[model samples]
Target chain A: MSLALSLAPLAYVACPECDLLLNPVVPEPGDKAYCPRCGYLLQRPRKRSIERTLALSLTGLILIVPANLLPMVGIKIFGNSQDGNLWTGVSALFKEDMWAVAVLVLLSSVLLPLVNLGLAFLIGFHLFMHKANNQLARWMHWYEHLNEWAMLEVYALGIIVACVKLAGMAELRFGLGLFAFIGLLIVNAMLSNELDCYFFWQRIAQLTKK
Target chain B: MLKKPLKTAFMQGFIRCHDCGSLLKSDPKCLCPVCGHHVSARKPNSVQYTLALIISALCLYIPANIFPIMSVTQLGVAETHTIVGGIVALIQSDMVPIALLVLIASILVPLMKLLGLSLLLLCVHYRWQVNARLFTRLYRVIAFVGRWSMLDIFMISILVALVDLRGVAQVIAGPAATAFAGVVVLTMLAAKSFDPRLIWDHQLSYE
Candidate 1:
């Protein structure tokens, strides 16, 4: 092994879960190193992670347009058919003077997910280009914060629950947006789990050094 | 000093940055060299911030449960449902699994979070030295499940969107949806503001 490769194992890592100090043995591609004390994922550096995440993020971003534009569900009640998109619900809440719910929906369902996916794309692009600058680092930080607040999966579950509740009262039909939203949720989740922060920082450090 | 020796990063004069997981020399006001995040041996004012957030969430919890979350208007007869009432409606409609899911996600999880956080805060305040490991696990559970409490709010949004039929039927979000969302957000913020390391800090001090 090269001197640098050998010395890389000397870096100390503290388990975020149990605070156990450990020297991690870097795993091979497709393997994961879990903290022995608390089973917190220590590191898992996948080959071409940036490329894979970038592709997934792009797919999610593409799906978002339809998810927001097309009606999420079609409803027929008393021989009257109506179709409503995600924004329709948001506007309906606002019309009812439920400002807080409207804002929450707009933020969690609409804004945060887009921003999160956008950040993922940006970070992936930067990493792939070997441009490890301070701005990229800052964006990565913002990405971490935004990831916590983006509740697309929760929102998707909510749609399912709504459909179940409304099935008895109305002739319900799933829209194209429903499947698109589901696609977005799955893609976004895969991208999130594939992102290993420690590996990203290490990659950035390598790039900055060169 | 009549105390058992303990091994800790703090005792070795090092602290880990909560944001980027970088280890640095212990300093109350130092910025993390790697991530530019503020570094401290412990999160500054963790208890106070957590307490304030918990109290705010608790205050919102009442109105969230009492007032209507959504109203379903069918044929000019509008029926409103609160959080519990909504669950009851689901049960009446034979959506037993969804009702249970909502009961757990919307109600039980948030309630557990509030109670769990308060217990952790009190334990830290009183310096209770029992089951630190268990409480740490509890904190992890609360933090993991905290954001899921938004399920009900999301459901309300979807319902309001899909069930808009003007005069025949319409699902309208109510004031309580706002309050319920507020409770979930506040509890999540409270969980974020809490420093789980404090639980171990007490152990070090007691030793």
Candidate 2:
């Protein structure tokens, strides 16, 4: 219950069921640890978490450029056709006096993704080159810090809402951009799986020690 | 046959007290009541988790508003609604509870949870100089309820899937949905990134 001051390198002691961390322990292969509090399994992470994460992050960065530039969806209505991209949607909201909503849209969809990608690139680049940078560490902290604002599911909900309303009047078409956007979502999730900040930092600690 | 009986007896033989490992007991308490060293259990990333949860929640909060949450089409012309519009439509339809629930699940809950997580993380990250137990307990409560943020997203997805009017009433997802989903996920990650032991680090240092 007291605050401990020793900044020892953290370990991978986590509850399996709930994914909470446990105290550091040395375990034999196949030995299991459980959190009495949350009943989660605790153990060292898979060795490949970083490489897999880096690969996914790279892929995400590549796809994001096109996802933003391409029209996500198009609508044709009453002899007037319109093409929409991510930024235009929010701008249109501003034009319609929905400035608050437009700002939210831009932050979550645009800013958050950009931040996440930027963090991944920096972290991945540093880790790959076998260098340790405190600035990179801070960026990792910030990346984790701002990650909460990137709400893909809520964005998905917004898409549904838009589709529902647009359907009532316009001829909507699902554009390649939209498909790519969906692809971005899935790939983002994949990248998260591949990267574990704890594991990455733990490895950094080991290398720095050397 | 004799050898078999001997092996079986050895296998089933009771030595000391099972509970305390005292001495061979004939028939009393079979369980260990002495040392009480039953396996200890607890959350692995209890403190760090709350941090991640809160951070992601904050990010989701922004996009949950910025873009039009839903777009409506009338006679080939399209209009869009932000998160507020969805709430307004619910209010207009006389579904106050549902509207309120949407507002909470879609907006308020995620925000509150994120904010709560940030406070908790700040304490833990800063080494819990004050009220460590009280704050940690509060964090547990907040982390427990973080998933409800998904309700609004689910509502939108189900509505999109179920209410299709083809050319007349087709429903599509909006940019905000992706952003919102990202917030939920990112906050969860942030919560995961926290090192709860940071709190106890100070305590152990004093010792």
Candidate 3:
């Protein structure tokens, strides 16, 4: 526990879920503090969370290209073959004038995830390099709100469901993009676990205190 | 009381950053000194906003299920599949496990969302002195499972994108795709807008 954090009754923490007030405690490194009333995770002390999250976010960014552009799955029937990548789904929907659905798919599956990773990268980069400006807060705030809308893991499940449905109808082929996507999903999952938002907010406040 | 010395931070004159969870002294001009985002005692009109979104989602749920979600065209024949129709097709083909997954993800999850949110809204509206803690957990469950409803939409997109061997066998998204997506998105928004804290306020009042 840092001296700053140990002075707790001065800054009572409220549970976001259930409105329970608590005196802040310094959880052991990588341990969580949950609301006694509703079990909402108050915060956790992640060890070097910024560095790890930055690496995962960068990995996610690198995986995004192949995950979106390359075929995740292919099907063959009666001597004919067709393969689908993440982009093709949205484009195909657009071609059929299902533009609203296409746009939703594109945003949730592609653009929003990119925004999240990009913002995280930017914030982490600035923080690590000791370069904090007025814009860091805005970016961090945006990142918090936009994080929920990025559904890469859900999209990955959708891919698996799609493959299963097609299994009996034709010969199914797994593509490299599928592996890349799984990697991205793992990265995303770990990124969330490694993230300690309270820590980030404290760090940002310290840097941008000017 | 859920714990000893029961009180909320807001009651203690602390306004937490809604986005970052930083506690700031609650003032007339409440803003998180750390993140500079507005921090309210509670989300204003949370129940009303949640109710509105849930009502709209219930309305869209009809078209989402009524119309064909996608059509598989093969050998000059087109077979359109509604959500239920897809499950039946799968069952007839003896893919019980995948059939059950779709039935749950596409059908049951959305239904649960609509009904669950409505009940939670009712509880908050009435300020019923029911078990707030349980309902809070229910809210968490609903929020967690809500995203899985996108399973069918995604599957359709992939099918439409992948099975395009023209005149041999191709899949195309149908009219219901938009409605289904709307239902999922609206329910998610509703869940996001809801304040679970309200569920406990009444409990605290009774104490």
Q: What is the lDDT of candidate 3?
A: 0.84
Q: Using DockQ as the measure, which candidate wins? A: 3
Q: Write the per-residue lDDT of candidate 3 for residues B1-207, one digit (tens) a residue.
A: 123535877777777777777777777657777677777878877888998899899999999999999999988799999999999999998889888999999999999999999889889888888877789889999998988888888888898888888887889999999999999999999999999988887774523
Q: What's candidate 1's i-RMS value?
A: 5.5
For model 1 the local lDDT of residue B176 reads 86
* lDDT (Cα, tens digit) per residue for candidate 2, span A4-115: 1222533223322222223454333334444444323334344456566677778778888888898766667556566776767566555555455456667777778877
On a 0 to 100 scale, what is the lDDT of residue B183 in model 2? 67
Model 3 spans > 4 angstroms off? A1-10, B1-4, B204-207
TM-score of chain A of each: 0.90, 0.78, 0.92
Best by lDDT: 3
DockQ (CA atoms), all models: 0.43, 0.04, 0.64
Recovered share of real interface contacts in candidate 3: 0.75
Residue-level lDDT tens digits of model 2 in B72-126: 5544556677878878976776667666767877787667667767776676656
Model 1 agreement with the true structure over B1-207: per-residue lDDT tens digits: 112222456767778777777777777888877767788777789999999999999999999999998888988899999989989988887889999999999899999999999999999999888667678889989999998999988888778777777777888888888888999999999999998877866664322
Residue pairs in clash, model 1: none
Q: Please give, for residues A1-210, the per-residue lDDT of candidate 3 as tens digits.
A: 453363334356678888788877767776777877777877777888788878988998999888888888888889788888889999999999999999999998999999999998898888778787888889998988888888888888788778888887899999998898888888888888886788787788788775
